[model samples]
Target: MKDTFSSAAAARQAAQSEMQKVDRGAATLSQALGLGRPHLMPQAAVTVEGFKPEIDSEDWLVKSVEHTLGDGGFTTHIELERQGDGNARDQEDVEDLVNDPKK
Candidate 1:
């Protein structure tokens, strides 16, 4: 019937429009994440070390944290350093530096 044919055509058009919207959104997201262009060199494997945290050990102290964003995606690297000898003054200084409210 002509009604049935028109209904099928309308459904196809709606599906196509939805697909176009999805494609545009994907393209925008890829560009925003810096993946629109090809990378000159393939991304290297991410290496992580010293992630274990011990409640009683000094290994819980965070030495530094680094973040890298590229075509591959975002990667976070955290380095844990052992606490120095139980010196109260040094520990206080380190705590102050690490827990700076302004930072």
Candidate 2:
């Protein structure tokens, strides 16, 4: 994601802060629980109680939110993503899955 800032200094700060990411796409817990009312939107801060020590985290920030109203059901779908530490974290995730037997 990219944003426009008034000065170059502000842009640099933003870049430094968002350097690390956590991917939650394959994780079931991050899935949205049917939203009630149109309350949240993109860029909103929502707390997530994570599972792992350093992998699962509560530092979740809302990327996008969809609020819908229609006949019977919304009759549509949604899209969401969580960022992980680029490539290394992804490899770790795969290894965890393969080595884990309780899953």
CA-lDDT, candidates in order: 0.35, 0.45
**Candidate 2 to truth, TM:** 0.38
In terms of lDDT, the poorest run of 10 residues in model 1 is: 24-33
Candidate 2 residue-wise lDDT, 5-75, digit = tens:
56555654444344344344433233444544355555455554545765355434456656566654542
RMSD (CA, Å), each prediction: 24.4, 12.3
Error of 2 at 39 (Å): 1.7
Q: Which ten residues in a row have the lowest lDDT in candidate 2?
A: 75-84
Runs in model 1 lying further than 4 Å from the true structure: 1-59, 84-103
Pairs of residues at least 3 apart in sequence or in different chains that clash in candidate 1:
none
TM-score to true structure, per model? 0.26, 0.38
Predicted model with the maximum lDDT: 2
* Residue-level lDDT tens digits of model 1 in 1-103: 1122234446444444444343322211011223332222222212223433442333233344455676678755544333333333344443443344232
